[model samples]
Target: MSDTLKHLLHPKFLHMTLFGFSAGIPYFLIFSSLSLWLDQVGVEKSAITYFSWAALGYSFKYLWSPLVDRLPIPYLTRKMGQRRAWLLCIQLLIMVAISLMAMTDPASSVSALTQMALAVTLLGFSAATQDILIDAWRIEASTDKDIAMLSSVYTVGYRLGMLTSGAGALYIAAYLGTSMDQYNYFAWKISYLSMAATMLIGIGTTLWIKEPKKAAALVHQTSDYLAVVGVFIICVTVLILSYQLTADFFQSFRNQLFAWSQNRPLSATLTTASQLLLALCLATITARLVATTRWVNTDMIKDVYWSPVKDLFLRHRQHIWLLVGIICLYRISDIVMGVTANLFYQFKGFDLDEIASIVKTFGLFMTIGGGILGGFLVVRYGIMRIMIIAAVLSAATNLLFMMMVNMEKSLVFLTFMISADNLSQGMALTAFVGFLSLLVNRQFTAVQYAMFSSVMTLFPKILGGYSGGMVEQMGYANFYLMTAVIGIPVVLMLLYARKNQVFEFDQQSDQKTSPH
Candidate 1:
């Protein structure tokens, strides 16, 4: 067998895909599939969009990633090592959270919706934590020679997991008789319960794998672990109090914007911006709380919280803001468009079964193809070149959706749209993820990568929360046009960075050190 085939078949690499799959499941469940559930239950468009905030835990997960990098579970850590122990523990939490979500009926009452949203928040938080540990483990397990391949495998697994939660869940729901005209809560409940069962794949993999060298070597005392846990608890308490205190102010502010603002776009923009700012403020308060505590004096705390930021700024001070801009905006167009995509399809008169088969199942293969092609192009032409193409493709494809608005709902036309859209999505995400991974400092892999990932998704998700409102006010054609137009900024930023050679040095360094 060829060397590439050998590596693909390796057990270590196969397990990495499973880890990626596990991480991918909850993300779509919370973001994509859950939106369909809310819509079918007769939830208002704006309310469904607001429900998107339940996944904000993903945007702020960097806050607690440091703890995952070093914190140890009591008995589990001793038995299976830190990373695996955390993996198993978080997997169980996800299972419980998902099961709870399945049991709640969002259509029951406003209070029930609120409770269901909280359950989603818990699930999102657990899934985000799982991502942190799994990333660290993936990095720790690979040598420099194969990290890229391992990352690709992980991406494949992650996409496959998306397939399950995205298409598989829809198939189940449709089979059990949930449609736009009729709301079958039992259908959705059974679908989610089945999705929850798939968490077993991750739990089994966690138990089957051995701890990597770096993860195994990360040993801390009982007192230090307890102190870190205390610090985490304090931060959580501060975040909760901060949100509760400011919730009314933000709500009133949003109300005023919608009530008085003449320009609808401006109103939507201000509302989303204010909510993003609130999230950032909460994270800042948590950070400040951590710093002011006695734990700040501890070496572990210093290394975890301060050192990563310091190292990143020190290394890239001149280009740090530009890099941040790129990371923050790179995926904005795709995410914002995706937030309302299923709703848009349903509005266009497609049923759940049709959407599941074409958009999810068929689109899955196209995306995987694009991802593989993207990985190859990045290898041949470098990330900057491929990323530019990916960006352009991503922005340009939204125009197809715009055209689809005018055309009749032919399966052929829908298939063509899905092909173009998912291809761009797959390519853009593959390049973007690889770019982020390349920028991470190995010393702070978990924390720094988490920070990068968190920042990248933060603004996009914030904007996505207003997507339904945008659709409500601007209409579908304009929304798709706006999504496309926003990609201009990302392209401009990439061009500026390329002109200034911001990442040239890092790429050179990686190439020089990597084995050929």
Candidate 2:
């Protein structure tokens, strides 16, 4: 085995793998599983879709990332490093949130159930925080050359968690219930408790691992606390002011803009531009206010909380852009198709049993296989090449589902499509994660990677929200085909990126140009 592969197979890699599993398992429990629970209780699809907005907490994790990066729990910070301390705490929160979700039923009165929804939202936010810490640890603990191997291991663990929470939880629920029509409260509670137990494994692993020693200068001091509070106040003030300003501005201008554009059709571009401007204004005001608060002056908070984001961006512009593009395109096809898969299965007249057996069970294994294959390929061939191949294969896999759209829904064909789609998704996801790790600076790994992964999720979720309408309009066959075609622009972008040697050249250039 190559040195990288050998290192990946080491015990530390296994530790990271378990950590990834702990992080991944609770996600679907709060997301898809919870959606099902709500649906079973007769929650409207519109309400369920709104619940998905709870997931926006994940996308905005960067907001609190600096805390994970800087603030250390008193004894925990001393016992464990920033990353581990943050990971363990957030994992604990996730456990609590999941258990609470299991205890409550959304079918109860809206006033009573609002707390339950909040609990699930908390779970998502906590999980997102844990993800930030994990991403930081993964990058900090590994070397550039070993990142691919580490990434693959992490992906394997992550996918396993997704599979268990999705299919495994469903099976458990199905088996425990007396009838399919009755609610499986006990089963769901056990499954959620099981998820909590699995997270403890991560806590144990964290305890066993040695904390990364902080440099003396980097250690937190009293001033850090004051700075943190100051920054917090400034950030809050700016957000409130910006919201008021924008709301007032929009309300004032709405009629005028509508009148001017009466004859002019509103394109997606115009809509996006309007939203973008509002968001940019809010973000800018918030950041500027935070900077003015002077929270960065103290030693404890200086490096931890108020370090210069602008400097990093300027220093790593090319890599940052590449990271953005990779994140945006990594699972474009998979995410787009995911929004329509169940409907497609139903449209084909496949019953729940067939769908569960083929797509959920068999399909999950194929995904694991693809992740492992992609990881191995990265170790063997390098990340860039693996990324190229995985992207192309992912695009191609969409066609398999399209072909099945009009077919007789044979078991063999279902198996074939599931295998192709899942395997390719696994490969692409692994490569994409490895690439993300490479882009992060170890000093700000959690915050930077959180930003990247958040962006990775944001666009997909926004686009996916409309997927049901699209499928309803175009029908399943054409929808799948269109999903496949969506991959084309991303593939072309990847090709252009590779040909330009974006990351490679940027790294070399940074080294040569740095003021040592």
Candidate 3:
């Protein structure tokens, strides 16, 4: 076996893989599995599609990651290490949240949807928080040369987790719910309970693994409290104001929209798109305003909040926005497609058993192979080079689903199409994760990573929420093609970044220490 192959199988990969599994399991339980559940339970498809917004928690996790890095749970911090303790606490919350979801029935009452959304949000928030710690831990654990190996196994493990959680849960629910009573709420509850129990994978890993020793201590002075409070109040204020503005605009736009389209599909899409754009604009403006505002607490707040931005700006210089733009657009095509994929499978006449067996199980192995190959390619040829290829292939694969449209649901055809799609996705995701990992500064790893992950997710999730409307308007064939076309810009931007020296793919982990 080659050194790359050897590195991939190193025993150390086990821990990262387990944590990756833990991360993947909850993610799909909240996302794809829940989508399947809600759709079967008679929730409106659009409403179920909108539930993807609950996952925006992952995008915003950076907002609190600084706290996770800076503070520790009172007693838990002493009993367990900082990252480990946070892992345990968050895992406990996830278990409880999943259990709560299991007990609630979306068909039970009017608030069933709301309850499900809240539960999903809670699960997502907890899971995203866990991710913050795990990413930091993984980076800290590996040497620069081995990061790719770790990244690949993490991808592999996460995909396997998805296979089990997504397919396994579907099968378990199907088999257990043979009786037809209000859409088999009882079986779903047990499946959720099973998901809750899977938290043990993370909990056990946290206990067994050693905390990274180089982790920094939070610097604090009594005067810093003022800055912290100022940041808290200002950030909260900005969010409140932005939300109010978005709500008013949404309502006003709705009233005026009928002049253009009576069905309101176009109006709804524009409104959703506008709200996302407005939120992004407000956030950027808030960052700028906070950075420039001169107050007694300026230095303190900047250190606490804007340090990551300053570090990145110094590295990227004037090209920061271009870099941000690329990251924002990179993963969106697949993500948006993912939001409505299960529904599409159903609409195309595949039953739950077929979806579970084929899409989830067969595609899982293809993804693992693609992800591992992606990791090896990154180690050998460098990231930017492989990312260019992966990006192109990733975009192209979405076109496969277009062929499934209005055709008979042949398992053979679905298998070949999805296998190709999953393979490309695995490669793209592995490269993407490694790419982000490289950019993180050890000093602000949690926050900067959260920021990057958030930027990557926010637009996609928001736009994906409107997918039901998009498909209703354009139909799946056009919508899938549109997703493929959207990915073209990523390839162009990457080539430009490489030419301009904004993209760095040749780093062996030696993480930069922040200048004190």
Candidate 4:
């Protein structure tokens, strides 16, 4: 092997790979796995919609990102360095939270399970924090040319994690030899415990890894303690003000808000007073923190206190526009089709058992294959070409479902449709992630990626919410055909974006302007 390839295969690279695995595994445990468990337990479809909202945690992770970016664990911060210390802490929490979730039963007491959902939410938050650090470490550890290979390694580990959570868990349930309902819940608990165990591997890898050197300038910038405090205070105040304004709208229109909030208590007087108190306290503390901590000798503190929000907007205008467009169009067809697929199966007379076994189990492997394949393709060909091809394939595969919808109810046709869809989805997801990774400035990886992912999710998820009503309005054949048609606009946009060479031009301009 070339020395560069040999270096990448060394123990340190393996460590990062395993750590990536640990971070990726629990995500589906709280998401897709939980969805299956809920479906099996006979949760109402409408209630299941609320459960899906729990996924909003992944999308909104940017809210606490500044905290993760800034705060230190009293002694560990100095011992392990900022990034590794934070990563280790969050991994431990994820381990503990998953074990806690294993002990709760969703059917017996949903309120208790809701508490478990909160614990899972905590896991998602911590996992996201770990991802922020890992992405930074990956960038710093590799040379520019090695980035594609490193990304592929990370993708392989991530897909392996997903396989364990999705298909592995299902197989365990199937083999347990219990009633279908009991086996489903038992399988979930076991899967969570297994996920917890996976963290140990990451922890061991982290211990052996060396910390990257801190930049001298970054250290100098954070020495101002008062500035750090001032920035923290202002950020907190803005968050509080935003929340209070939202609360006021809810209170003023209690009936509408209550419906959405599921009738959590709301009164105008209390809402007004609460908002005022929160705003004042937040503003006061923020002012004090920024003033006191502006001179701390840390990059962490500077990032927290600085005006990144404004800077990103002004500096990378074209890139930002590309980010917005990619986010909006990436999964438009897949999500829209997904929202109605279960109903389609039901209409075609497939039992729940058959649907779960075929789509959730076998189809998952197809997705894994596609992810691994796309990763290799990205390494072999560049990200730009892989992205264009993936988009085209994703759009084309929607037609497979349209074809299946016209065929008579046959398991063979169903399998074909599921396999094709999953393959396209996996390939598209791999490319999308790579593209997003390239766009992020490692300094702001978590927040920028979060913004991209959140916008990507919001529109499709909203459209998905109306899917059932649409299926009711239009029959199955028409619905699938409509989904196929939806992919055309995004595919065209991708082709145009590629032909114009937007990202390439931006990179050239950036390199020209940068100081040598």
Choose the strongest candidate by lDDT: 1
Q: Which of candidates 1 and 2 reaches a greater lDDT?
A: 1
- Model 2: lowest-lDDT 10 consecutive positions: 263-272
- Rank list by TM-score: 1, 3, 2, 4
Off by over 4 Å in 3: 1-11, 178-182, 221-260, 270-300, 499-501, 507-516
Query: Whose TM-score is higher: candidate 2's or candidate 3's?
Result: 3
Worst 10 residues of 1 by lDDT: 505-514
Per-residue error at 406 for model 1, in Å? 2.4
TM-score of each: 0.91, 0.80, 0.88, 0.73
Taking the tens digit of each residue's C-alpha lDDT, what string does model 1 give over 1-516?
Answer: 498777667798889889988988897788778889999998877778776777778887887887787777778888889899999999999999999999999999988998898899899899999998888887777765565666667777888889999999999999999998999999999999999999999999999998877763454565765676676677666656666677678778777886886665556557656655675577667766675767554676666778999999998899888899999999888889988998888888999999899998898778877777777666655678778889989989998889888878888989999999888878787778778777878888888889988998988887898888788888899999999999999899898886666886446634654678
Q: After superposition, how far is residue 375 of candidate 3 from its true place, in Å?
A: 0.8
Q: Give the per-residue lDDT digits (tens) of candidate 2, residues 1-516.
A: 597456556787888888878777876776566655665566543345345545666777876777667766778777766667767788789889888887776666786468776787788888888888778778877876677778878887887777777777666665666123676567777767776677787788777776655311235654665566566556646644564556555644655565776522232224434644576577666666566555565454345544536545776676766556667867778776775565566457764456657777788778878888998777666666677788888878888887887777588988888898888888988888887777666667777788778878877666665565565456667877887787877777777776776776334534544477
Order by lDDT, highest first? 1, 3, 2, 4
Candidate 1, pairs of clashing residues: none
Question: Cα miss at 462, model 2 (Å)?
Answer: 2.5
Worst 10 residues of 4 by lDDT: 214-223
lDDT of 4 by residue, 327-376 (tens): 68788788777765655665577654565578766776687677778776
